[model samples]
Target chain A: MGELRLMKGNEVLAEAAIRCGCDGYFGYPITPQSEVMETLMARQPWEETGMVVLQAESEVAAINMIYGAAATGKKVMTSSSSPGISLMSEGISYIAGSELPCLIINVQRGGPGLGTIQPSQADYFQAVKGGGHGDYKLIVLAPSSVQEMNDFVDLAFELAFKYRNPAMILTDGAIGQMMEKVELADFKPRWTNDELIEKCGSWATTGKPAGRKPNIITSLEMDSAKMEANNKRFQEKYRKMEEEEPRYEALMCDDAEYVIVAFGTSSRVCQKAIELARAKGVKVGLLRPITLYPFPKKAIAELSCRIKGFLSVEMSAGQMIEDIKLSVFEGGCIVPVKFFGRLGGIIPSPGEVVKALEENFLKG
Target chain B: MDIKDIIKPENLVYKKSELLIDTIMHYCPGCSHGVVHKILSEVIDEMGIQEKTIGIAPVGCAVFAYNYIDIDWQEAAHGRAPAVATGVVRLNPDNIVFAYQGDGDLASIGTAEIIHACNRGENIVVIFINNGIYGMTGGQMAPTTLVGQVTSTTPAGRNVDLNGYPMKITELIAQLPGTSYVTRQSVQTAAAVRKCKRSIKKAFQNVIDKKGTSFVEVVSTCNAGWKMTPVGANKWMEENMFPFYPLGDMKDSDKKEVSNN
Candidate 1:
């Protein structure tokens, strides 16, 4: 245990990563996420922990650096915001297609272009869906507070290695800059790179000489048959991931008729709405998804079987609602999956969410 | 294990076949990349680092260097090999790491990476091939293209009026404190090829010694772009390229001769 100290969310993540024994960090300075690199550079872990930190030329170069380091079976990471992340999409697909394990953090801002630098959960689809080309999914962890930001960095790396795929810590600008008291573990490296390579070297890109042919580390296999085999290997791994990685938390859902579902920063607001609605004799409950990709379908469906209707709330313009509809009705039930929210950086207050619930879930 | 055994003509040393790739070479017949690749393979064989060396190729005519070299490789976007190599080598310092780049890829596009890697004193070998022309893009002017020399982009004979003069990359990098070895050698003549091999080998050896940033800037020929025969191009590089780019070791702190004059 360490002394309780207040820190920004992104700072907490950078500190946790160093403590976790991340060997490489390549990132370009971008707002909201700039602190991640600044703290890492000032810390100069290169001399002490053999941690290498580089300010990459661009987001594209940064992610590719992660790809290269990851090929050596190192726990490497990179962080960026909206436009910067959009640039990393192509590399993300390549890393995923290569089946490399790494962590990427996106402190999401409003988007489509140079969207506002304010907080927004509009990237929900981008985080869960393959934000890049090809078939892939990032194990997206949404952090609502500084504590979760600290906690999720370790969790993201754990899940990344466990599934042999990329994991994303998807938060918003508020979570990145806002301060909160955090209790972090004293320094201890979880595992060395040799340990990671020993477990993953069969597919790694470490060079082999005359007696052994050189290893080819590429996502491009012009041969359709070979490409299909690679896809199959990833598919089986993803199936195993789906079986084990779904996570969510429900509040006051035991005796409710209407369920309000949300996640990340929006989930906090939705929980407040659920409490306020119940205080007024309105039966309401909240379902918060900790893992956005493995969208808690089974649990939501079981609850759907009991509730009258499901009200979807979020900070995005109806992005997570689509997944909510699929999860709520996957069990063959016909409950209406209603939606409500704002777009870009605008967030609906709990009062506004309660009103939407009354109009959509309660009155109906 | 011997150099001759590794570089046998019939063995397809660096690859399963030949450096004469079937990928429709984007380079002219006399472009020095073919020669550079042949010698690089020979060096890899001699040092016994083919198994340990990871070659990161930059975007240029040599984009397919990975295909020709018989070792592990990952293709990097323009000017990014130094950064990418940094990632790989930092993770596995025991493994040999190198970057292959042309003037355009290393000097213009990746200048930041090349300079920073050297400044940070990263232990890696960088082979910088300076042919004075963007050979891949059909004889376009390059950062290393000499003043008063003509190319596609500088058709008016690289006048000092509009077009800037050549960039002395090796000379500039030698100024950085992180560099332990930097040489401006050439492969123009048979005699020079022997010297070039020694220069490239020393660069790689410095990396093995944990010495920071070893750079070899080879003043190469681009006969296809120069519109000259192979023999004439070699002579032209001797007369024209050598004067502006110069030849020999620029800086090597461990050995004698402080500068490559």
Candidate 2:
């Protein structure tokens, strides 16, 4: 256990980055996540941890900066809201194509356009299903609490470097702005250039040493055959991730009649809904996915065999539910997966989730 | 000595820069990119920073610059070289970083990146190549294309109202206080090539001195894109491109002190 402090999700993210040995942070301000940069600037991590914090001109430049720094085998990241991440699509695609390791935190607000600054999980599809162009997938981690926000920063960087792919924390505004007690991690020193050269010299764009040819960082494969081969290679990595990285929390799932599948802040609401449903003598459980990209497909598929049905509770009309339905039904098992949710930054309540269960699964 | 003995190792007077890879250049004949690439390689070799230098290749004719220059390279998305260079220099301050960008990749779509990176006074070099038309993309009009210049996009010679005026981006960079040195040079003649090489060496030295952004714009020619022979293109560039984008240093922070004194 490290120091415990009451902090907002955004603020803890900044502190955790410093403690996790982050080399640099380049981000532009957007609602619900601006405090990420604000907190870094106030903490002056440059004076303490030697972290480079810069307020970029726009989300596009910020993400590109991550691409550049990540190429040098540095632990760097950026945070943004929905519309801001949308502007970063081009840079994100380039980063993915180059196979550079970096972290991106999307404390998602309402979207479609510059929708709202309130909490929403509408970006589930964008995060999991390649928000940027090209055949690539980000290792998506969804944190339900401020503690997870701190913990996931380190985990995100670890997974990013482990696979040499971009990783994202697909959180929402509620978790970003809400204050809670967090036990921070112990400080880890940023890797020196010598250490980085030792580790990632084979691929990283560190300067070319005497014996080696120059290391080129680029995503453009002009040859069609080569591009297809690269795509196939990425697909294999994603499959391996699915095998090794799917993470979820199954609460009261044993011998349950129906399961409530949710993630992020929606999972917190579903926890309450599980309590509410149980009070009414309903055997309901909660299945909260922690890794959204390497989704708990196998878990959901197994649950489909035992549970009567599933109710996906989310802050969006229907985004993650599609993945749930596909995962459960892939084996031709008709487990009766249904969706119940709000939209445009509206937080679905526990009562609403319980009502959805009673009306859809419990009755008749 | 006999003629065969005269061809001995000691008698060798000139050789291509060791930094240039033996790969056959893909640039079109008479294109100024090969000339600029040769000069840059020679400069890097002369500075003995081949092991420490990192170059950002642009998206136009010189997109394959990495194939020619035997140095660590990052292929930036069209127009994002400066931002990419910023990422490199900020993290590795000791490394010599520079972006080799064409006019379309710098002045148009990537205008924000170049301006912001300059304004931030990033300790890096920007090698801007302003050919009046896009070469790799089938001769399209570029941001630096002169008025009355005909291109694939401008079927009937460029009109100011329709196409806008040619941008003097180096001049714009010179105005920014963050820039320590700004110059526009050409590689058309032997004398011009020597001057351009000197300018590039100064830019690299500026990086070592931590003297902020140093921009060297090489006003160049695209003979294939211009529908002309190599000699014709050079003549046209000398006559038209030189007047709009004049040669010589526009801003030098070091020179300011001597002149002031």
Candidate 3:
């Protein structure tokens, strides 16, 4: 509650980055998310806070830049859409392998291959599952509103540095382009050189002092035994994250028989859909997942015991519903799990969601 | 005098650079990489910048460069060393940054990264090793492989129609306005090795002075990949490689000042 302003999601993201003391931003322009770099350029954060803003030659270069800076234990970030993120996957895998902390924002558009520039949630599997070559996890956060977009920048950095892993704001074109009132955070000073050394001196690639050994940041381990040991350490950290990080918002779940599961913009639609379903004397609830990787599995599993069925509403072709079914199965519940989605950048409406739930679950 | 008296401190004439660790290098016998690495370590030790230098190791035979050079390092993905060095230098401008890359890593898959990094005029050093063939991943045709060179991928000698011609990437790099110094040198002889060392020192000095990109290409040999003996490889390189990839400075911003003065 530092200051209030009406801004686009992309602009708020850039402003929040400066306010949160981000060290650098390296990005390439892609439609539906170009405003992110555009806004950073217009703000001239370099003049104000010494934040390094660079328009890289391509997404591949941008992500590698993030890798280099993050190895020095700096709060660096990049933003892009689906195709651009795909280009960054190789670097992302390297970043993950090196166990460096950084932030990535994907304002996703529809895509099998540059499918559309409009809103879509088609990257859920790619984000939650491993999109790159190796077995690694990116702490994924889904923000449904412009306010959350402004807030998640700081939160993502905090969690990333806490775990020494990459974190991503898995948003979409709808929230990226839409305008809303956001309460911005207060300005925090960027870390001084002394502070950076104090925080990251143990593992970061800051220059070696006279008394210490050189720090080498690499992912290549020639020996299979050592490589397996490194993989085990990564998996252990992910398990701790799964135990401590799953977040969700449960709406009217006290006495509902059926629940609508969604995230990001689709979750907003389900909120309205819940009201429509209730007015028709149908008992419905909403379970909105905020962290997609440390998914709200426990909550969904608990809900499976009481709810008659779950309708996973998404803007893709039945991707998240598989997770819902898995949650129910893990919870030892035999409840029905169904999916309703719109593909190719089409956002499902409240009325359409209500109709889909009735036709898929209640009718059967 | 006794042999023990000759080995005393006062009689010492040469010793290994302290900047190089005791770890044995994995480079093949008579490989040019070993010579270049030794020279680089000596330069860093001479300048006393070991505590302030950060090196980017590219994906090739030099991937384990961090093991040999006692300095902070980041191992970049294939062809991404320039981009990674850009990240390090922009954020930590006080540190001397450099990228060590191979022919395949720089001239082919990473063409875009090297070109854009130089064009942006990033204040960093680029050490390019052009052996004209891929040595780490078996003997394959490299972007800098000579037109008539025979490799695993080009067994019948490179066909102009299929493999195109050897890339003169250093010449392209010299054309970029962001570059302040660009040179091509070799390591076939003791005199040539000294010359290459001078060029590398100059490149590092340029970066320290905040001059734009400094590039030094060392035309090298790969005996195992070339299917020749160590001595034979050096003779073959002098006979064929030198004529195509001639040694000498291609561009020097400092020369402009000397000429003007």
Model-by-model lDDT, in order? 0.83, 0.92, 0.94
**Candidate 1 lDDT over residue span B113-163, tens digit each:** 799888888799999899888887789988888887889988878887788
Provide the TM-score of the second chain in candidate 3.
Answer: 0.97
| Angstrom error at residue B115, model 1 | 2.9
RMSD of each: 5.1, 1.6, 1.6
Clashing pairs in 3: none
Instruction: Report the error of model 2 at residue B100, Å.
Output: 0.7
Note the DockQ of each predicted structure: 0.46, 0.81, 0.89
Model 1, runs deviating above 4 Å: A1-6, A38-50, A54-58, A112-114, A181-194, A206-212, A228-240, A297-308, A326-336, A362-364, B1-31, B48-51, B67-70, B131-172, B221-244, B254-261
In terms of lDDT, model 1 sits at 0.83
Residue A90 accuracy (lDDT) in model 1? 77
Q: Candidate 2 chain A, which ten residues in sequence have the lowest lDDT sum? A: A328-337
Model 3 lDDT per residue over A258-341, tens place: 999999999999999999999998999999999998888899999999989999999999888998898999999879998899
Candidate 2 residue B77 C-alpha distance from true site, Å: 1.0
Between candidates 1 and 3, the TM-score winner: 3
Clash totals in order:
3, 0, 0
lDDT of 1 by residue, A1-364 (tens): 7757899988888888888788879999988779999989888888778788888777877887898888777889999998888988977887898677899999988877998988888888888998997888888888888988888888888898888799999998888988999988567564564676478667666876345555656676657999999888887877777778888888999999999988888888888898899999999999888888777888888998888898889887898889888877687776988889888788789999999988886564
Best DockQ goes to which candidate?
3
Evaluation by TM-score, superior candidate among 1 and 2: 2
The weakest ten consecutive residues by lDDT in model 1 chain B span: B13-22
